[model samples]
Target chain A: MVTAALKEDLPGAGREISIEAVSHRFDLEGAPLPVLDDVSFTIEPGSFVALLGPSGCGKSTLLRLIAGLDHPASGAIRVDGAQVGAPDPSRILVFQDPTLFPWRTVRANVALGLEAQGTLKTEGHRIDAAINLVGLQGFDKAYPHQLSGGMAQRVALARALVNQPNVLLLDEPLGKLDSLTRLAMQTELVRLWQQSGLTAVLVTHDVEEALYLAQRVIVFGPRPAQVVADLTVDLPYPRHRGHPRIAELRHEALRHLGLEASW
Target chain B: MASIELPLEAGRAPAPVQGWTLLAALPWFAAVAVLLLVPDLTYQPLGRELALIWGAVGGVLTLLGLFGNRLGRVGRWSALRGPWLFAIGAASVLWTVVTAKTGWLPQPFFPTPQAMLEVFLYDYGKILHSAAFSIWLLAKGFFFGAIAGFLIGVGMGWSRAVSYWATPLLRYIGPLPATAWLPLAFFIFPSSGSASVFLIAFSTAFPVAVLTWSGIAAVNRDYYEIARTLGASPLFLIVKVAIPSALPHVFVGLFMGLSTSFAVLVVAEMLGVEAGLGWYLQWAQGWAAYANMYAALFVMAAMCSGLITLLFRIRDRVLVWQKGVVRW
Candidate 1:
């Protein structure tokens, strides 16, 4: 009951994101290696979208660009008609590695965004709320080393949610978790995004995960990555993994990722 | 071993002290008997005092064996050091026999333990004064140097311009011994005290600076990105993310600096300072007062170890999270 009331008071408001002709590259030694090539998409406000691609296909890079942690080499990413120039608290990125500051306890790690925003003094209560939201109620003082992979990622989620970001850019956030934790976190992710009323863009290679969690799964091609397929998961909430529609989507999604989908 | 038994339940009586545990008092009692019954060939000061100390140790160990269960942490600890107490008591008795009672060894050079004990009894005032000076000097130099090194390391780590300039300077200066600059130090500084401080600081700064720089540089790039996306400013990124991430390395640098500071402290005091453990050792050695020199050496050992222990305690407290993480 306490958690329910606290969740309602938590801060977040979904916002629209527009990526137009976005491209990015990295220099290895000397030559330029293009990663994202003219990738463009629009994410409606409060919608859950999963960017499914093969490993190293630049879906994660796209998430980084959306979060404004890094800029695309060319083209504009706008949030509500404002050119995204730098990272803002409104769009928080949860990294694949959790990247929780090892020195900080769970409470301190969750408090980071607010602490940086200078809102910690007034909104310290949000930290406890977010921790409870992640089901880490009794682990506020636990260090990262003391946590399992799933729990650490939960703390990472709590950390990002505490700031109440409008767009949660997950760069394969659950990609490293064990299978069971991965499934559990996938469910929790949908619940968290829906409850927070925030737009979420998850970059993952897991086709089933993409279909299971997101409203729409956008597939990408390899290397200088380009859009390969755009899919809308028409299934209802509490979608079954063994559902006939999910299997069809998985086959189609794998085909787009250059897999045979033999099974 | 008895005390290291499987822990008793809360409010339960502690495991009964073993027979061997009670035997810890045997060596001390033997030492007391040897001191009282053995006739000394040479006059050794503090013979009675030595016997009394051993008698007290034997008495205490006996009491601990009988009633240690009722006591708390201290009692448990003393019980655990049963072997250590026996070894120490036997070693003392052996040393006294070989050096003073038989007069088997050369005189003056191998003064009995009591002769060294006499230094503590009579010359404690001057010796403590020297120890105090050493502590003050070490604290000043190590404190200033460590602070400066930490700042420089952070600068070098965070800013390219600072790193570009500081790297060359650090590479050139960090490896060279701080005492190598003694000539310049003495000439430039206004007083011997300042010169000593500078030398010790120089010794401490190199390791701290190098380590801090490496720590900052090795920080995970994702850490910075995570902080930035959370609406952290550049200042916050450096202070909250980069610094904490690099802390394990910084502590390593601090440790290296602390030990080197001790070496540099002694060298500086011997060369320049009017008072300090090194100066006391040098002064006593000049007068052929080997006992006094040995006493000062003991004091120096205790001081260095004490400071090192303190640093380790701080590192443990500050980097408690780092304990089970990585190589830390």
Candidate 2:
């Protein structure tokens, strides 16, 4: 039984991700504005990694690329040796804004991916499990407008979880929540990542958040983003907030982000 | 006593009795007295019937004022609402004195209350037929126009090629009123009824198409991105994402289209229909049967208002999620 539990905790559920020399740009008033600067990184299967960066550093853009919502201008992104051509149910992105369909109830919003995959009939119970996982059991019938900001984000996360995706690409998913909610959600994120056994890539500007949750925090520089530092948090899950290692890593991340770390 | 005095206060009490309820019956009694005492200057056929109606209203109001507190909140509210009933009674008495009791306002132009009543009683069948015919024509044209507009709007919204083709044509033709299409429409269609339908549909289709287009265009790009990353197909994006997001705008379009259809329907009916409220109005005017025209106009107003209310009811039900967020 102990062996079986250990096996379940292994990386069997998550797929490996590789980004080889990926670059992307946006057309701003007819001028090509580079966002991702030939950035390349590999994420190990079932690892919780945070893409820590200042705002507009293209970390969110990278998350989108990994989700296969947008194609990189150059280079390739592969999941377990297969290059992703388009969005697949195996990968999902939860945006900063919950972006819940305002017309849909919480349950209906969570059911979106299953509905898209035509698997709702068989896997319908996943919607309930997802809602419960996010601690939004009683709000299943509530509309997006009725929800508080943190609850709406929870619904968004639940929406991503319902798909049972191998990789969860969260693009600053807790960026809009209040500081207290953000801190609470940071712990929730770690618990969820451990429970699901999926590869989690969180893009966040909050250095402390990265340190608190991710097993590895990959710090990024300003626009046309390139990797500046990748500090692995060697601590285990249920990390102490007052850990000295977290303070050191946060200072290191802040220095790379060009911010004066007062703390 | 304080509870009765401050009955209208929020959450004070569900049922509140007002002493003014009994006073509401007074004006109706006054109108009835005037109907009996006043001398008729013209031959008003339904004066007795009018008096009976007034007497009945007064009797009902008196009964409601006396015992409506026992019927709970809705009843108590109605019983307390007596000023409007008084106003109606006062207006009737004044109208009788001016038109039937005296020759202050000339006949055929300003008919008496009894003359209006005569038209209602005697010409009920013909008016009902015209009203029914108008409704059928309105429904057909509105349904077809709404469906066509919705399709065009969705097509234009989702496809670059369709938008490219439709935009120029819409700009050129959409601004022109349906009356401008009248002569051409009649010339093309075999029957004037079909021609009228075309006009109503044409008027309705424009607003619905434009609003639907704007609605779809205004959708947040983040919504599309969210759906896409969740494994939605291109078709699923349009139908599930684009359509539902655009429904509020579509309803706005439908409402605008519906009102415009009423105007076009009247114009279309006046131009060629054998029977309709509009045709009946024109016919009554031609024959100097002013009373019939008045009755027709009243029916037309009631029908239009009723249809609008029905649309609002449907909108409320369908867009229940938008209750506090968007107010039409």
On DockQ, the candidate that comes out on top is 1
Q: Which pairs clash in the backbone of model 1?
A: none
Worst 10 residues of 1 chain A by lDDT: A3-12
lDDT of 2 by residue, B32-91 (tens): 888888888866787788889989988887877777777677555756467776777778
TM-score for each model: 0.95, 0.94
Candidate 2 error regions (>4 Å): A1-12, A260-263, B1-17, B72-77
Q: Which digits, one per residue and each the tens of the lDDT, describe model 2 over residues A95-154?
A: 888999999999999999999888899988778778877889899999999999999999
Worst 10 residues of 2 chain B by lDDT: B10-19
Displacement of the residue B6 alpha carbon in candidate 2, Å: 9.1
Q: Please give the distance, in angstroms, between residue B129's alpha carbon in candidate 2 and its true position after superposition.
A: 1.3
Q: What share of the true interface contacts does candidate 2 keep?
A: 0.89
B1-328: candidate 1 lDDT, tens digit per residue: 4434445564676567634446888988888888779887677788788788888989888888877767777677777788888788888888778877787777778778778878889999999999999999999999999999999999999899999999999998789998888878988999989988888888888888889889999998988888888888899988898888888889899999989989888888888888999999989988999899989988989999999999889989988898778664
DockQ of all predictions against the true structure, Cα-based: 0.88, 0.83
TM-score (C-alpha) between model 2 and the true structure: 0.94
User: Model 2, residue A182: what's the lDDT?
Assistant: 88
